[model samples]
Target: MPRVADGSIPGGPRHVALIMDGNGRWAQQRGLPRTMGHREGVRALKRTIQAAPDFGIECLTVFGFSTENWSRPAEEVSDLMGLVRTYVANDLKRLERAGVRLRVLGRRTGLPDDIAAIVERAEQTTAHNDRFLLQVAFNYGGRADIVDAARKHLDRVLAGETGEALTEDILGAGLSTVGAPPVDVIVRTSGEQRLSNFLLWEAAYAELIYQNVLWPDYGPEALADVVTQYRNRDRRFGGVESATARVVG
Candidate 1:
């Protein structure tokens, strides 16, 4: 692709997703508790949110806690839940003031009552904001999301909502990320290369970038580097090459 005058690609990704990994390893390397690493990771999340708009990203999604995480030690699970409460209590006001709509994508049925309340409040409070979107995937799994979406479609059909058959659009609209844009790029930290059941359907055409930096160490520079790599990717989306691709090839 030809570079723009500013030495950057024009019309950069509008949506970026991240798998923030290596927190426990980062703390273990420092002889600190894993919880400490999680705290620092929260700081990195704040920095990323502040920097995303600068890169022309309108929506940022981060995988926080996964459904499979419940199998970890009880203490760690409790700590993770605590972190969710603490993050919302500390950041909700600032996030609302900054016009960042926060959407927690995951199953709510199994969430603790208090944490569920906080999630509801955060989403309701910022429902009117439109400046940016921050989607946190907590207690989420890509396979589970797909199952939930399928159930939703089946329920509608049983309720006689429509006689039409299920299609991609129909199923997609039933996903937790219903109104959100398709992910443009998915970045995994700590050099991990797997999706880890994050955004399965939404990432069908996303550019995947892996970074060696640990989650606590991630910031604007790391994301910027990811975007740079994303720019060089030739995204064909299962179609023929574009005019730019032909010229560059």
Candidate 2:
């Protein structure tokens, strides 16, 4: 991992989520096919995955594909799916060797059977690794996640298990990311400031960092900057801090 001029990130977040944007724009800027940008973005993903453990991050969730992404040109979508297959086929063993557990959080109904099979196989193979949990939100949408969880909860209630008195814990249990820690910080690249339907429920209190850097160009140094910014903030969670407690020891 490449280190910044300074030492390690101070008080880095435990869980980080990323909305990787601007692949198409990056490719357009370079006079290359958009598919090439996606290809390069994969390289960036590899870099981030390798660097996360170095920063002591326990979990990293990346927005690989959203439900809305299906609306893009069919050719582009197909290319993205091919990229997914390539990543799993080419990198799964390396990821497992590095102690990274792979998890996919999304509805798999629309994925090609072969692609879905690869996802399942990758998850099963990496299930025992514990150094870090890497979640790829492929074909995922925050609102869709909430609705799916709610439907499951309602079904349980109707089946005489528990009725109408659902709490956050009960609801959360049905979500795809039930056991994972909530996102601590969310970074959106490509100068976009919107969350774009990524992890709405889990990111309720997450500090967000928007960067002008495109996804294909993001590296460990950019990630370190996000961590540095997170460390500088005073996270009071919604309460006023005691005067003495507010002072840094």
Question: Which pairs clash in model 2?
Answer: none
| Cα lDDT tens digits for candidate 2, 7-81 | 334456779999999999999999999999999999999998888877868899999999999999999999999
TM-score of every prediction relative to native:
0.93, 0.93
Query: Scored by Cα lDDT, where does model 1 land?
Result: 0.89
lDDT of each: 0.89, 0.88
12-116 per-residue lDDT for model 1 (tens digits): 677999999999999999999998999899999999999987777889999999999999989888988998989899999999999999999999989999999
Stretch of 10 with least lDDT, candidate 1: 1-10
Report each candidate's C-alpha RMSD, comma-separated, in the order given: 2.8, 3.3
Mark the regions of model 2 whose C-alpha exceeds 4 Å error after superposition.
1-10, 242-249
